[model samples]
Every structure is written in C-alpha cells, then in structure tokens.
Target: MSAEIVVLLVVFVGLLILNVPVAVAIGVSALAMIATLGHVPTAFLMAERMSNGINSFPLLAIPFFVLSGVLMGQGGMARRLMDFAAAMVGRLPGGLAYVNTLSCMLFGAVSGSAAAAVSSIGGFMIPQMKEKGYSKEFAVALTATSATTGLLIPPSNIMIVYAVVSGGVSVAGLFMAGVVPGMLIGFLLMVASAVLMRVGGHSKAGVAQVPRFWPAFFGALPSLLLIFIVLGGILGGVFSPTEASAIAVAYAVVLGGFFYRQLGWADVPKILLIAAKTTSVVMLLIGASQAMSWVLTYENIPQMVSEAMLTLSANPLMVFLLINVLLLLVGTFMDMTPAVLIFTPIFLPVVVELGMHPVHFGIMMIANLCIGLCTPPVGTCLFVGCSVGGTTIARTTLPAIPFFLAMLVGLLLVTYVPWFSMALPGWLNLF
Candidate 1:
C-alpha cells in the first residue's frame, strides 16, 4: 500500500477504535487521504462524490422500503405474521422457539431491516416467550440471531446497496439468490432452537395455547400478501425493485390506514419523520462510503488485495475459506451497509477471478454480514434484542453461540455450494 492508503486506513481504524460514528469516520478518513495527495481541492470533489453516491435511481428503494417496514410494524402486521408462524410450528418439540425463528424470518423478509425485525418481532415475542417460561437469555439470543434473516431475504436494503456497489448487478437476481440461503439459515436456526429447547426442557410451554393453522394463516394473509405483492411484482416483472418499493409504500399505507384500520391520519407525520431521518442516515453513510471507496480504488487497493489473496491460496476453496474468515471478523466490528460498500469493491474482483458468480458472491457477502448484526460492540440487532429482553450483552452472548454457529453453517453451504443461492434465480432467468 502507498503512504496515502496507509494513512487513510490507519485513520479510519483509529477513529472506529475511538468509538467515532461510522459515517463521520469514513467521511473524514477519505478527506484526509485526499489531502495527502496534495494537488486537488478535497472539498469540491468529495461533495460531488457524496452527491453522486446517493444519486442512483435504485437507491430510492431504501427510503420506501424503510417506510414500508415502519408501517408494517406499526400496523400490527408483525404480530399476525408471528401468529401464522406459531400456528405452522406450534406443535413441534420446541413450538414457541420454532415460532420465534419462523416469525423473525417472515418479519425480517417484510421489514428488510434486521434491527426492525429484532425490535418489531422481538418486542412482542420476547415478552411472550418469557411469559411462556422460556429462559430470558435464550429468548434474547434467539430473537437477535433470527432477526438477521431479513438481510438475506428480499426487498432488502442491504441487497440494493450491494447491487449499487457491485456495478448494478441485477437486484432481482440477488434477491432470488438470497431466497434459499435465507431459508437455509432460518431452518438451521429452527433446528438448533428445537434441539436446545428439548435439552432445556421448555417444549411444553406453548402447548397450552397451540395456534391453529387456518385461523392464524387467515389472520396473517393480508400481511403475507405484502410479501407476495412486493416480491411477486418484482419476480413477475410488474416493476423494478425501486418501483416495487413505491408499491410497497402504497400498499403499506392502505394496509395500515384503510384495510387494517390500525393507522390513522394522526400517525402520518410521525411515520414520515421517522422515515426521513432513517433515509438521511443511510444516504449519508452511502455517500461517505462512496468517497472512501473512490479513494481506495484510486490507490489500486483492490488490485493489491486480490494479488495478495492469490498469494495466500491457489485453490479456489481455500481462497474462499480465507475470504470468509476475513469477512466474518470484519462483520464483528463493522455494520453491514458500510462493510458492503467498503469491501465489495475490494473482494468482489478476487472472487470473480476465481470463477464465482457476482450474484452468488453478493448473497454470500450478505449472509456473512447478517451474523455481525447479532454480535457485540456493533451488533445492532443484538443490542436491540438485549434491550427488549431486559438483559446484558454479557449474559445474552453466551446463549447466542448455537445460533451463531447455525448461521456460520448456513454461510458455509451458501459459499461452497453455489446452488444454494443461485438455483431459483437461475431457473427464473433472473441473471
């Protein structure tokens, strides 16, 4: 690496260690690196880059999806979805645990935000699980880990961001690619929950109020329809992902306001304000990340990284393992959005050179980052989950071990077996 690259990397990492906000850290680091170059004006170019970063047509999907998720959470859609999941899995050995896992999968899919899933689904489920005699630590751990499935599922903001960073590879293709792997992770989590439940003797807590399939399914149908409408429209070619997000917003409004009667005119301003604030944070992060990415690219960092990775391993599988390990560590400290922006450019070409598909790599990258959302120091979902469950991170982290392993296993399958992520998209000709 050049002196400039070294300075940028050091400043960024040092700021992170000092607990600086990620967007500010990235923005200042990029600016500092540019200053080191010593010929051009940093302010104007950085301003233009930040503006251009959030300038993509596809990026409009972020705010719409954010609004839709907020509406769905406030409209009582999450509870109904949980009811449906409970009904389907209510009689299993670890019934409520199954419900928790599946509910996160469903809610996360709809919300497209893992933190939202943790808070929305966990806000209800964690209390209910505790009422049903589930261990508090287990409840918090399960909720935090399970909520991560949202990032791997469709209508995911992370996936859209990945698409933008990866040179606009099909958003639909990445969404399709995520379907099986997302479920795989959910299923693994379910199995782990079931086994742990049986071992801990908590299987009977949910039997007293077994949920019926037809009733729960009917109750959740409208909520389920949101998924079908947003995802179906995309898969059926009715709209692009960005267009689908608008439809999502419209549908969420109708569902919350008219159909469900859970929302009212009084709620509009609050929801808009929340959405606007969220959009600003995400867009600024993207802009800062874009500027940092440009600096790194300008330094030929990706080329150097790729060449170094090749030196570490000639075998494709070994190369993948090394990359996965590095990414997992990265995820532990970095949030998914910035990590995706920063690393995708660096690692993508390495994998592409190894004959992996971009869509598959995109999905793999997401799956790995989802784990980070459930980890400590920077795990957004984990923090929210512990707060909901009324527990400490120290206490909750231990119980989360099995779920983390389950995610890693799912990651391994998605990484090595391309079919896990690529099959549906391939069959549907999304690529």
Candidate 2:
C-alpha cells in the first residue's frame, strides 16, 4: 500500500476507535490524508467533493422522506398502524410478536426508516408486549429485529443514497425490487416468532379480548393511503421520488394534525427540529463519504478490491456469499449509512462482473446491512428497542438469536433468488 493509503487507513481507524461521530471521522480522515500527502489541495478538494455529494437532484428526497417519517411518527399514524396490525394478528399464536413484525412492515412502508419504526412502533409495542405477558427481552428482540424492514420499504432514504452512489441506478426500480423481499422477510420473522413462542410456551391469553376489527381497520385506513400516495405515485410516474416525499410529508402533517387530531401545532417546531437534525447527520455523512470515496477512487482501491475478489471467486454464488459475510461483519460495528456509502462502490463492480442486476444487488445489500442495525456493539435499533423495553442489550440478545437466523435466511433468499427482488420491478416496468 502507498504511504498515503496507510496514513488514511490509520486516521480512519483511529477516529472510529476514539468514538468520534462517523461523519466527522470520515471528514477528518480525508482531510488529514489529503494534507499529509498533498495529493490535492485540501480546501479545493473538500469544497468540490462536498458540493458534488449533495448536488444531486435525487438527494432532495432524503430530507423530504425523513420529514414525512417524523410527521407520521409524531402524528399517531404509527400507533394506528400498530392497532390495525394487532387486530389482524392479535389472535394468532404469539400474536403480539406477529403484530410487532407486521406493524414494522406497515410503518416501514410509510416512514422508510428502521429507527423511526423502532421509536414509533417499538415505543408502543414493547410496553404492550410486556403487559400481554411476553418477556421483556423477547419483546425487545422482536421490535429490534422487525425495525430493519424500514430500509427495504418504499421512500427509503437509503435507497436514494444507493442510487446516488451507484451512479444513478434506478431509484424507482430499487424501491419496487425491495417490496417482495421486504415482505418475505416480514413473513419469515413472524414465523420465527411463532415458533419461538411455541417453544417458550408463551400464550396470548393476556392480551385485551377485543372483538371488533372495524374501528381498528377504519383508523388505519388513512395511514395506508399515505403509502399508496407515496409509493403508487412514484411507481406510476405521477411523481418523482423527491416529489413523492413532498406529498407524503404533506399527507403526514394533515393526517397527524387534522384527521387524527393527535398532533397539535405546538408539536410542529419539535418535529421539524428533529427532522432537521436527522437530515444534517445524514447529509454530512454523505458529504464526508463523498470525499473519502474520491480519495479511494484516486487510489484505485475499488479496482484493486474488485480484481482481488474476481481472482478468488469465478462463481456468482460464491461471490454473493463472500459479500454477505463481509457485510455482516461490518454491520456488527458500523451503522448502515456510512457502510453503504463506503462499500457499495467497492462491491458493485464485483456484482456487475457476476452478471447480477444492480437493483437486485442494491436491495440485497440494504437488507443485509439492515440486519446489522440490530446486531451487537453498534446495533442502533437494538439499543433503541432495549431502551423502550427498559432492558439491557445482553438480556435481549439471547432471544434475538432466532430472529437473526430468520433474517439471515431471508437475506440468502433475496441474494440468490434474484426473482424475489426483480419480479415487482419487472411488472412495474421500472427497469
């Protein structure tokens, strides 16, 4: 490796080890390497790369989607969706777990964020699960695992990032491709929850014995329409994803403030503030990552990595498996955003070389890394779920094992069965 590369790697690892925020870590490392090597003038390079990173028109979707998710979360749409999911599955064996999974899927469809799913659905369900006789750890495990669906559902900000980073692979096609696999993961998670409930001899007798479904159905209907408006509009070419996000945000605000009468005007500032903070974090990461990617490309790191992988695996299946292993390991330590930004460029050429569709690979990569958001060391959702359940990570992780296995299985299906990710895209003519 070149001296510059060695210095860059050391600075990156040092910043991470010191627990600096990821965006800052990346920026600082890139700046340090550039200064040390004098490869490019620091000020000019930073300005150029940062501008280019956030310059894409598609990136406007990020803040809009984020605001929409926050609006829905604070507006009581998440709770209503949970009620609807509970009504549909609350009578089943381990019904609460199933309800948790289903509710995450529904909320994910609208929010397009796993953290939002956890904060909204999880805050409501974790308490209910405990009240309904589910173990706190199991409840936390279920919520944390289910929250990952956010990355795969429509309006996903991560999908937008992937599209931007991958040099404009179709965002609409990526969105559609995620639907089937996202639902498939939900189904498998629910099944895994059922089996676990049976093994643990948990019963649903503790839940409220509600007989009427109409109220729940009616309450959830409006929120479901938001999904249609955002996703359907995008898929139908009625709106771009950016435009869809704007519409979705408007819908969420109206639903929360007027229709549901849950969120008041007083809540508006807080919602926007939260959304702005989140957007800043994501945008800064994108900016910093762009700088790092610029440096990596200059160093020919992606070419080197791709060539090395091609030498190791001529078979597509082997390449897929190897990538999964690599991602899973990285996911355990890193949050999804930086990981995707860093690795997508490195691995995408490998996928293209193996004759995989970029859309399929994008979906598979997101899903795999989403699993990491629930894993140990830096599992954001796991920590969030535990906070909601008032439990420790150690306590929740044991029950999380089965759910992790279920996610792994789902990942394998999406990775190998390209049809699962491609079918919806094909039908929609999104390719």
Candidate 3:
C-alpha cells in the first residue's frame, strides 16, 4: 500500500479506538489522509465527494422509506401486526417465542429497521413472555435475533445504501431478492425456538387463547395490505422504490389514522420530526461515506484489496468462505452502516471476479452484517432488545446461541444457493 493508504487506515483505526461516532470518524479519517497526501485541493475534494455521495436518484428512496417506517412505528401498526402474529402462533410450544419471530418478520416488512422492530415488538411481547414463564434471557435473546429480519426483508434502508454504493444496481430487484430469504431466516428462527423449547422442556404459555383464523386474518389485513402495496408496486414496476416509499407513507397514514384509528392529527408533528431526524442522520452518513469511498478509489484501495484476496485464494469457494469469516469479525466490531459503506466497494469487485452476481452478493453481505448487529461487544440490536426486555447482555447472549446458528444456516443457504437471492429477480428480468 502507498503511504496515503497506510495513513488512512491508521487514522480510521485510531478514530474508532477513540470511540468517535462512525460518520465523523470516516469523514475525519479521509480528510486526514487527503491532507497527508497533499495531492488535491481540500475544498474541491470535499464538495465534489460529498455531492457525488448524495446525488443518486435511487438514494432518494432512503428518506421516503424512513418517513414511512416512522409513520407506521408511531401510529401503532406494530401492535396490530404483533396481535395478529400472536393469534396465529400463540398456541404452539414456545408460543411467545414463535410470536416474537413472526411478529418481527411482519414488522420488518413495514419498518425495515431492526431497532424499531425490537423496541416496538419486544416492548410488547417480552413482558408477556415473562408472565407466561419464559425466561427473561430467552425472551430477550429471541427478540434480538428476530429483529434482524428487518434487515433482510424488503424495504430495507441498508439495501438501499448497498444499491446506491454498488453503482446503481436495482433497488427494486434487491427488495425482491430479499423477500424469500428473509422469510426463510424467520422460519428457521421459529423452528429453532420450537426445538429449544422442547429441549428445555418448556410448555405452552396458556395465555388467553386466540379466537380463530378469521379474526386474526381480518385484524392483520391492513398491515398485510401495506406490504402488498409496497412490494407489488416495486415488483410490478408501477413505481420506483422511491415512489413506492411515498405510497407506503400515504398508506400508513390512512391505515393508522383512519382505518385502525390508532393515530390522530395530534401525532403528525412528532412523526414528522422523528422521520426528519432519522433522515438527516442517514443522509449525513451517506455523504461522509461517499467522501471516504472516493478517497479509497482515488488511492486504488479496492483494486489492491481485490488483488490481494485473489492471491490469497484462487478457489472461489475458499474465497467466499474467507470473505464470510472476515465479515463476521467486522460485524462484531463495527456497526452495519459503516461496515457496508467501507467494505461494499472493496468486496463487490472481489465477488464479481469470482463469478458472483452483485445482487446475490448484496443479499449475502446484508444478511451477514445483520447477524453482526446481534453479536456481542457492540451489537446494536442486542443492546436494544436487552433494554426492551429488561435483561442484561450476558443473560441475553445465552439464548442468542441457537438463533445465531439458525441465521448462520440461512446465510450459508443464500451464499451457496444463488437462486435464493436471484430467482424472482431473474424471472422478472430485473438484473
């Protein structure tokens, strides 16, 4: 590596070790490297790189999705979705666990945020699980793991970031690719919960039984229709992902304010403020990441990394396995957004050289990073779940073991079975 690249890497590590916020760390580190190189005008570089980062049309999807998720989250749509999910699965062994998984899946469809899912769904169900005799640690663990489904499901903001960073790959296609695999992950989690409950000799909670299918079906209809509207619009090409997000916001307003009667006029300002705040944070990160990415490209860092990886493993399978192990380790230390931002450019070319489709790699990468959000030492989703469930990190980590295994299985399936990420997009000719 050149002196600039070496200094850039050092600055990044040093900033991170100092516990600087990720966006600032990235921006400052890039700036430090640029200054050290003294090869470019700082003002010109700053404006150009920042503009390049936020200039994509597809990137407009981020704010819309953020607003839509905020509207649904604030309007109490999650509660209804959880009620429907609980009704459908609440009678089985480890009923609340199943409910947690299913609810996260449903909530993921709408929210596209793991933290939001855990806060809203886990807040409601963890207490219920505890009351039903489920251990507090197990409840927290299940909720944390299931919340990761939000990253896998359609409408994921992280996927939008990946698409933007990956040279304008289809956001709609990525969304479609995520659907089946996301559900599969959720399903496997449920199965794991079932097996774990049986092994631990845990019985049904015996809470007030759900009435029947029809009631549950009707109750969940509004949220289900929201999913159909968003996904159908995207898949059918009726709207771009950005437009689809606008539609989602409108739908959430009607459903929450009018149909479900959960949200009122009084809630509008707070919802807007929340959405705006979230959009600002995400957009700033995107802008800063763009600058850092530009610096990396200018330094030929991606090419160097790709060449190094190729030398390390000529076999494609070995290369992929090695990438997975690296990503898992990175996920443990870094938050998902920065990880995706910093690594996507570096890894995309490596995968392409190994004859992997960008779409497949995108899904696999997102899922792997999603697992990191639940891992220890800095797992954002795990911390959120623990807080919501009123448990400690140590307690929650035990229950996370089985769920982690289930996610690993899903990750391997997506990695090896390319069709899991490609079938729908291929049929639709969306590549």
User: Residues 129-221, candidate 1, lDDT per residue (tens digit)?
Assistant: 888888889999999999888778787899999999899799999888888999999999988887788888886666447678899999889
State TM-scores per candidate. 0.98, 0.97, 0.97
Q: Report RMSD for candidate 2.
A: 1.3
Screening candidate 1 with a backbone cut-off below 3 angstroms (N, C-alpha, C), the clashing residue pairs are: none
Estimate, for each residue in 1-431, the C-alpha lDDT of model 2 and write its tens digit: 89878888899999899999989998988887777767568988887898899899999989998998888888888878887887888877677778889999899777777877888888888888788778999988988888888678776899999999999899889988888888999999988988888778775443465435789999899999987787788877798988888898889888888898988989989999999999999999999999989988988999999999989979889989999999999999899999999899999998998899999999999999989999999999999888888899998888899999999999999999999999988987888
What ranges in model 3 sit over 4 Å off? Answer: none
> lDDT: which candidate is best?
1
Task: Sort all candidates by TM-score, best to worst.
Answer: 1, 2, 3
lDDT of residue 386 for candidate 1: 87
lDDT of 3 at 87: 81
| Whole-model Cα lDDT of every candidate shown, in order | 0.89, 0.88, 0.86
lDDT of 1 at 251: 91
Decoy 3 TM-score against native: 0.97
Query: In candidate 3, what are the lDDT values of residues 43-64, reduced to their tens digit?
Result: 6787688888999888887888
Residue 174 Cα positional deviation in candidate 1, in Å, after optimal superposition: 0.8
